[model samples]
Target: MVQKIVHDWATGKIYPHFQFVFSFKFRDLNTLNCSINLSNLIVVFYPYLRNALDYIWKNPERLLFIFDGLDEFKSKIDFADNCTEQQHKCPDPDVRCKVSDIVYSLIQHKLLPGCSVLNLQPSQFLSGFLMELLEREDSVRSVVYTFPHLTIQEFVAALAQFLTVAPRNIVKLLSEAHSATDGRFEVFLRFVAGLSSPRSARVLEEFLGPFPNETTCRVIDWVKEEIKRQAGNTWSEFGKRSLLNTLHYLFESQNPALAQQTLGSVETLSFRGLGLTPIDCAVLSHVIRWRFGLLHGTVISRIGECQIPRARRSNPASGLVEPLRLLMLPTSFSRDYEFPM
Candidate 1:
């Protein structure tokens, strides 16, 4: 539902207002092919490009090209060069190529003129690619604006519909929870933070409901009540307020995928170039390394107990290594904190 809302919003605000059209995707771009170049891409994306360009040429706002997961596509390409090919005859161009081929062509200037391009991808990866792309003397960089994870206000507004709670109440609850948790607030807040998108909400619900045993519920309820009492506030204080603000920062930073879903068809999404303070990076690195070590130890011990003969390991095609790798991968809570951002 939120995806629909955002698509509508973006189309209303951005489409038919720009002059040029350019798009890029990571996979076979077969779904976005058009009659003009149907042989090189997907056909489903044709209307989008047509409408977008029409809006740009007919209106003054220019156009905003919302490209998503370019980094993911790049990763896919790196891992499997010809990953998403499905043969289909083009009605017009009569040529045959993967969807990714078409997207690459557009980005390479096989499309119309007077257009801007927005490449969305993971922050760190996007930063590196954009830096490289912008290095050329004719490349334009300043027009691009990379939006960070959603702001506190945007988060609040996004969650407001599903929560049915006033903004102030949410804020008050978070404040009270923070004071009562004795600094375990980050863990608690994770349970309630998320946008209304199905994927984002699913992640949030899992956090909240993952451990649904009686003991977990009791802990949650007790914490809520205790926080309310300690904060000297009414039971109303136990509402969603505590989750609203810190969640904006915590959930968005913790789950960029969720952030993208919540924010909708944005031009750029990236984790690189994040202005993390030196102290913050230092602390994060320490925590990550410690967790990695603990998980590594657990894995090595598990593998040691396995009864596989040493000579079997010498078999070139033996699968022992893969399972051992999985067994050793970190399962600790602190370990996962490093990846979500």
Candidate 2:
């Protein structure tokens, strides 16, 4: 429902007249000082709103406040606390109080009674299709089970892009995902890349419906541009991880020609102080095979238990004779292993 509201607002389908519609993450709100009042808070967070403070005070109903990710809120909300009684009687929006008190007052209709407040948490059903897939009920209990693995969930999110009628801006979505600090969108981006394959699209169409061929092509093109953009610059650890993720996305696409074209000029590949899964190793091997002649000095360090298969480590068919170097390996797998590149 929050998403729907946001979408409607964005498209000017609802709240068209409202000039002050503020959306804030619950975690960001929790950082407010205890003595801050609604009036000061608005100016502190949004200085432009300072000019409209009097208007806001008089016409609170015109403003819509949306608080998202309540499930991640660190503080508990106690509706029956003694502080509620004090807050309820103090109806002035400018009165200084704890941020929690302000939240309670707002919810209880004591402060900004005419304004609308929307609180969104993950426990609430976000989509009917998702509810149908994950929600189950029995005689005594109800439960919601997520996909067995994180990758499956990410893939489903990626699939949702094609299922929607609206044209997806692949570059914008990728940019947003790339900027996220939590690594939440890493696998989802890879799945988006994988879904670009015609074989994958046809398989999905058999069960879901026809996917927009143009969107898939756009994703492929974006992936190529991203790889090319990063190829020239020297990368730090974080950037190296991003390059590795790009390799994974390319491998997921299963387009050998695309991989070769995008990564043909890559000279050195370094994945230092990073944990690698068996799947990650496989993806790395695919890139190595493509750029065997051009790539030199591939450095992998601090890979604890991720064992690269000896056969995959070397490819005799490629007829390449570049000595592979393993640096700072764990005691268990200290022996020299040939890398295909």
Candidate 3:
């Protein structure tokens, strides 16, 4: 809108009065010293809204104003009996009053008679603004979300790895109690935190670092809450694989060495100029090493229990030594070996 106004001035074109439209949002209206009256209206020179008044005045039949998200407007709207009756008189558009009064006037049909108005407010049933708009009409329409079970499913799926429920148990729980749960699972985020115990919530926070957005911050806050909650829960092996998966994803990143830091550098870290300060790469690497150690010990112990016959181990067609060399290959040996899938 600003660009259009500026362009007309620069290019020797007349202002488009018919195209003039203005939206006074919560923050925008707060800038006015007083309510949006003729004085403040002209202060901004919003392309002659008088023309809009005139146009709407002439065509008072069908609904003209479509006000969406009325809950977002911080201004207090007047719905008192006397105020409603007075505004029903359709006060002058130029009248010096609050913007809320203007909206009330429009809503009551006093401001612009015969014109239709639809206002959408939050979390209220029928006979709200609809009652005034529909004016005692016999018929109205509405629909409700019938699938309340979906919320439970979504919450469970998101935190499945954190829960100790096995595959069969999860399937049984979903089938038997899906409807009964009805959003109760949303409260169990700390349950997941308890499972991520070895990696405490503080440790997780240390990994996530700084978030530049509300969404990330909210997630981090919930996770922190879960971590504290998890401290009281019993130990579960449910989250070990999930932790490994997180480490694997980090290992595949461009700078794996830096990406996997438990106590990340004091200065904030970013990936590809995007705002992502990962929690702890060092801890992840440590966890991976610990897992490897356990697996190595188990494998060695099993091999010791049943000694391999030297003749079978030396079978030429097995290509066993080549695979071993790849498994323990050093940084220097990386360039020398490029094994097939």
Candidate of highest lDDT? 2
Could you give candidate 2's per-residue lDDT for residues 194-273 as a string of tens digits? 88888777876664557777778788888898777755443465766677677787888878788778876665555555
- lDDT for 42 in candidate 3 is 35
Model 2 stretches with alpha carbons more than 4 Å out: 1-132, 136-152, 166-168, 292-341
TM-score of each: 0.26, 0.47, 0.29
For every candidate in turn, the CA RMSD to the true structure comes to 23.4, 17.0, 17.2
lDDT of 2: 0.65
The regions of model 3 sitting more than 4 angstroms off are 1-21, 25-44, 48-52, 58-96, 103-180, 183-341
Residue 194's lDDT in candidate 3? 35
Worst 10 residues of 1 by lDDT: 305-314
- Give residue 122's lDDT in candidate 3 (0 to 100): 36
In the range 15-122, model 1's lDDT, one tens digit per residue, is 333443334444433243433353223234555454343334443235334455564563222223343443222222335444444344333333323234455543
* Candidate 1: stretches off by over 4 Å: 1-12, 15-17, 20-75, 78-97, 104-142, 146-341
Superposition TM-score, candidate 1 onto the true structure: 0.26
